[model samples]
Target chain A: MAPKVEHEMHYRRLGRNVGLGLSLFAFVAIVFWLTLAKVQRGEPVEAFDHTARPSLETQDSGN
Target chain B: MSDASLQSNVTTPAGDAGFRDFVALLKPRVMSLVVFTALVGILVAPNPVHPFVAFTSILFIALGGGASGALNMWWDADIDRIMKRTQKRPIPAGKIAEGEALGFGIALSGISVVMLALAANIVAGLLLAFTIFFYVVIYTMWLKRWTPQNIVIGGAAGAFPPMIGWAVATGGVSIESILMFALTFMWTPPHFWALALFMNDDYTKAEVPMLTVTHGRKSTRKHILVYTLLLAPVALATSFTSIGGPIYFAVSLVLNLLFIRGAIKIWRRDEDEAQADKYLAERKFFKLSLYYLFLHFTALLLQSALGVTWGGF
Candidate 1:
């Protein structure tokens, strides 16, 4: 029987680097997706009611 | 040859820069200060940024900080190899190659600057780039190796983080940001000199002309006290700014007093007395010096929490 030939792989082409790249992409994608969803749903990731002054700001006498 | 030997030949020892080693290269404790002060800078700024972008900007700033650290390690590996405190660091310990450290630092520097520009603004990105250049090229490569004034000048690199943070928020510099920069800038000399006072031998052996080695411990002590005195007013005055409040002022006053006292103690100890117990006074002063910076920044946070509102930047 003829010996089998296994193709050589670059480190960048290997699972580790590819996994890392994909994971980073996934993380960014998820964040963007969630943010978009939040916007569409009218729920902000950070919602500050401008009319309702922050308690900290209101407590101060800034005049 | 066995597969193990083949793998070992292919994977050089230099390839052993582990995850922990890379993280250590970032100087995480210092990075924490960078992140916090930068966050304060962002939060206190007059112009609000999107939270996601703000978060990414801070991360890039931190990565830039880590890059600076890596470059410092790369440049100082020779001396680091000798110092007991830093002997086991990745570059010095043979875990990571020196060239690899340089490459990593350069890569991170580019990524951080570009990413920061994308995440925040050109002003912040420029500040980050300047910080990296100042820390690596100016401080680590040149000043640290050349003069006793190294700490005095090099301190500017570390001090700029708060200003950068402030700029990220306001898109420009302000008096308050300058004051924050001054506090750290002035504080750096004394804090580092105290450590250099106690660790004089390390620098001496490494042939690094730290103040303690070049000017003698007495002069170093006197300088420490003088800088501490100068730093006190600046620290105290920062509390009166829009960002500072009752809590910050109180904490700054107390911390400065304690820090000055420690410097005074170190200054007064005669050479014989200081050496009587292997520089115990100097050692204690050095420990207190670490908390000095932390306390001031913590006070700022406390003031913010205390319902004293100050617009950022």
Candidate 2:
């Protein structure tokens, strides 16, 4: 539990933060664009093609 | 070739790279399993997540898992330092400080939960948050110190990833998701017990109350056999859901049979016999258990991809 002072970690910390932030931002933008596309096409963004489970559709809707 | 020559070649001694230590605290190996199971959960769901959103969701889920590892390391530093296998971890080895790991884990826990909520759905976010809390608070801080059933209850925390992954796409739980969760939950005890049979001394020395330490190796072997037997039915049950198919059933049936055979072998061995064979049953069973879950999930994913159903769906 000894407190180690920051000495040689400047660039490493900065690079790690920047990389994570950029990845998050890029993914957020892509998800937003996809959502918008679904909106434009008049589809529910949350709705999925449940073609394989035609029987489950009624159960899903009932729920 | 005296002091002057050595001085001329002086190089700056670099401190340990904090990033790698940070990643170590996250327990990348366990994080990979979390990511894989969560991915399978998403892929096997009847509803598909948007690829971009799914990627983001999985990343945050992995971070949540990593967050648990960090906090667990922080809390278990004492026991970790005592055990030979864990003595070299970031916190115990002094590669990273205690306060740093605690702060890092707390920050990532908040960030992952919030971002997952935004990118996916409330259910997935809430489940991820619960998973972190369960691991760090309920399991690591409590059961692990007090009881031998720690792995049994704490296993639920690791079991949540697939359920969260399913929630990310469907925003709700289903039989398939529940079965996936059950599969991991049931598989954990036997998998870990096999490891305990080999590494019992470490747990005993640390006084960690592992099954091998508290219940005796014979009882631990019996528990492993029972859990493996229980796991087989659950693994097969998934094939009756949206995720299961002929391939999944075939692979899982064979794997389960082999696993049962291995468990029985372990159950019958005594300490002397185990020593005679170099704990061969435990070691081999442990290795097979790893593949047992992976192949079952892999077969599930294959069936999901091909949209193959044996009239179950």
Candidate 3:
């Protein structure tokens, strides 16, 4: 007898997955555009700190 | 036993495992927890991730959860079928077969890890892979049948998601993520023991040595109270970190106090009185434990929001 093979995710599952993918893509696109625009206009984005951490030498270490 | 017998022992069940059964094998409830904690990890991290990468990372993390579930289902289908609590699951129900579940789990496990590496970073991908292996091989295959500490150690598998989330965003681990992991790890014993206290027979019938089964119910109750006490401090402490503030601290204090109170109330009642009356207190405690973790995580997010906007702390 030939060996049996199985596929867990089917076509319907795939189609549903694709729809979800598109929706997620759209949501991400909107957020990215807004963030980029805000950064361009010199607004500090609450989501990220653009500040660079201070170098080791800049901090007073008790020698 | 002969070598052939040993080989047959493994392969017989492997042959019967199926597709939908495999999908069912992934513990969906556990997977949802992984997704939620991971999402919180990403959200609360000091570093922000790009949206595309962030979404992809979360998606793969969810899939990693699904993969772990599938693998667990694959290995435990036999016990699953025997236990009343798990018997109705797809594999146990025979709606799908074992080999199918094994294949599905393995395939998804690879896909999730690799895709996560591509979408996010190597650390997150490696962590996801480790999470799957730990759940399947260490917890399911080995620890569950052999020891009462199965859930205690196995609980680590569930605790990895938030850490994985932290890695995906920051490409590394941190004290904050470790605290998140610790909270879940400590929370597992009481949450599960409460269910086990109520469902002791399920573990007994399946020959799984749950703490209640091995140590006796009184001991289990004691352990629950002790763990609840330990958990209360950690839960409140996490609220003081950068991601937390007054809101989270207040909520954590109130929630942990109530949680400890609930555990103590259950502990005070004799097991028979607790169970003979259909385990009402234990049941209520179990439900409350679910809300406890959610309330804490939500409060952390709320604290972050409050800090950012109010008084700009």
The Cα error of candidate 3 at residue A47, in Å, is 23
i-RMS values of the candidates, in order?
8.0, 10.9, 11.9
Q: What value does the lDDT take at residue B8 in candidate 2? A: 25
Q: What is the C-alpha lDDT profile of model 2 across A1-63, one tens digit per residue?
A: 111222234555565576668766976685676566446544453356544444445554854
Maximum-TM-score candidate: 2
lDDT of 2 by residue, B1-313 (tens): 3332232223212233356677888999999999999999888887867777788889899999999999999999999999999998988776676777899899999989988897788999999999999999999999998999999999999999999999998999889889999999999999998999999999999999999999999999999999999999999988777678888999999999999999999998899999898898899999998899888889988888887679744
- Pick the winner on TM-score between candidates 1 and 2: 2
Query: If candidate 2 were superposed on the true structure by all CA atoms, what would the RMSD be?
Result: 6.9
Error of 3 at B147 (Å): 1.0
DockQ (Cα-based) per candidate?
0.06, 0.13, 0.06
In angstroms, the error of model 1 at B19 is 2.6
A28 Cα displacement, candidate 2 (Å): 7.6
Candidate achieving the largest lDDT: 2
lDDT of 3 by residue, A26-60 (tens): 64674565456446634323334655433322456
Across B1-313, the per-residue lDDT of candidate 1 in tens digits comes to 4343344423325544445566677788889988887887777666766676677778889989989999999999999988888997888776578888888889889988887775566898999999999999999999998999999999999888878888877778888888888999999999899888778889999999899889998899899999999999998888788778777887888888889999899889878997788888778877787777877877776675565654432
Model 3, B1-313: lDDT tens digits are: 3433343323323334333344456676777787788988888888887766677788788888898787788788889978998888877775556777777788888988987886677999999999889988999999999999988899898889989998987889888888899999899999999999989999999889999899999999999999999999888778667776778878889989899999999889996798588999999999999999888888877766556432445
- Which ranges in model 2 have alpha carbons more than 4 Å from their true place? A1-63, B1-17
The positional error of residue B131 in candidate 3, measured at the CA in angstroms, is 0.9
